[model samples]
Target: MKAHKSKTLIVYSFLLLFCSCGLFIDKDCFDSNEYKFYLPFTLSPAQDTFHINDTIRLRADFSHELFDSITLKYYKVENEPLMCYFYFFRIDTTPTPHYTNQFSIEVDTGNVIISPDPETALRYIVYEYDKSRYVFSVKFIPHQRGVFLFGFGSEPQQHVNFQKKCPGELMDIYFTTNDGVDNNFYMMAQSPDSSMNAVPQHGFNRSGSYCFRVVE
Candidate 1:
């Protein structure tokens, strides 16, 4: 039974990657004339911390129009029942903290979609958006109370070792430099809770991070 499910899942994944919107690309990817890129815009939260039922605004601005298309991925953060990586929820005694399982808030990307909806959405592009070029914005209300994080990369913590875990969210920015440049799709993501910065977050190796706390 498990094997059959796996096969079905694989099929769906292919459909989403191939059938969805299309290949991600940009015009000005790597221009020799244009040297330095950027964090784009700092994703500054409304405040350093939030409270239950408090709405948090996460927004960033672009200095230049770099992304002809940006693939924005989201996970249903609030009111979600399932929060496990396994195809099926794991049956174990491991105390997986709520923060470790999923994001803390419900995200609403207002009509920002560049990809078409697939028949079996469960298989690919979980949730996608790229319509906006000047700004990346979302409004969410916290569901859980504690220090929760978003995005991928690595951090070290004592007692338990966690890295390369599934991301809370991910953004793939395809440049539209319109200039002869190297082929590279830039990425923007946040770091989950950890101590050591093992991988790149917010574009570079610990260039910066967005860590938030929620209270009841």
Candidate 2:
């Protein structure tokens, strides 16, 4: 009786497999199951700039991978006007940052974050902006590998161990270009707690050595 039961189970398994294969082999059935869903934006923090009253310039260089159309939005805290323009003719292909006459910003002190929403797959879009001068140079995404902490020392210590979460870690970074033309990207995590003795928080970690470079 046990042998007979095992044979029946094997038959059922084969039948299930045959049915599931219809999803791929059965074109008509597959079309019926077709559905459209929201595809998340594929973009990274290409580069950041920080400066005081000095002009902040940005030039974007893109590769074929960035072929998809991108929508860019610039947001600043106060009523500050952060100017921006898209350069289609000239794209700076070097490690240096270039300015465009199309974009300009007028702000006393604050941060300007720009996000590009590319409605597609692994395609990417580069965003470039500048500030007059800032306290320190902004840190773009790390190219190295190691665990990182964000919101560190604050009430909540948020840490990033890239091994666990890759491409999804949140960063609280600002930009600066005060030192010199060579931009210094620093790794920093925000303080999660307001008191002492509390564990500090961080965003993510880098597993390898990461050099800050333009994605173009």
Candidate whose lDDT is highest:
1
Tens digit of per-residue lDDT, candidate 1, span 1-216: 999999999999999987653434222222211111222323334345667777655444443333212322122222111111101011111221323222333344322221233321111111222342334445556665555433222112112111122222232221211121211112111223222233343242222234456678
Candidate 2 segments whose C-alpha is farther than 4 A from its true place: 1-52, 64-182, 185-216
Q: How well is each residue in 72-107 modelled by candidate 2, as lDDT tens digits?
A: 212121211212111111112222222222224332
Worst 10-residue lDDT window for candidate 2 reads: 202-211
Report lDDT per candidate: 0.32, 0.25
- As a TM-score, model 2 comes out at 0.19
Per-candidate Cα RMSD to the true structure, in Å, reads 18.5, 18.7
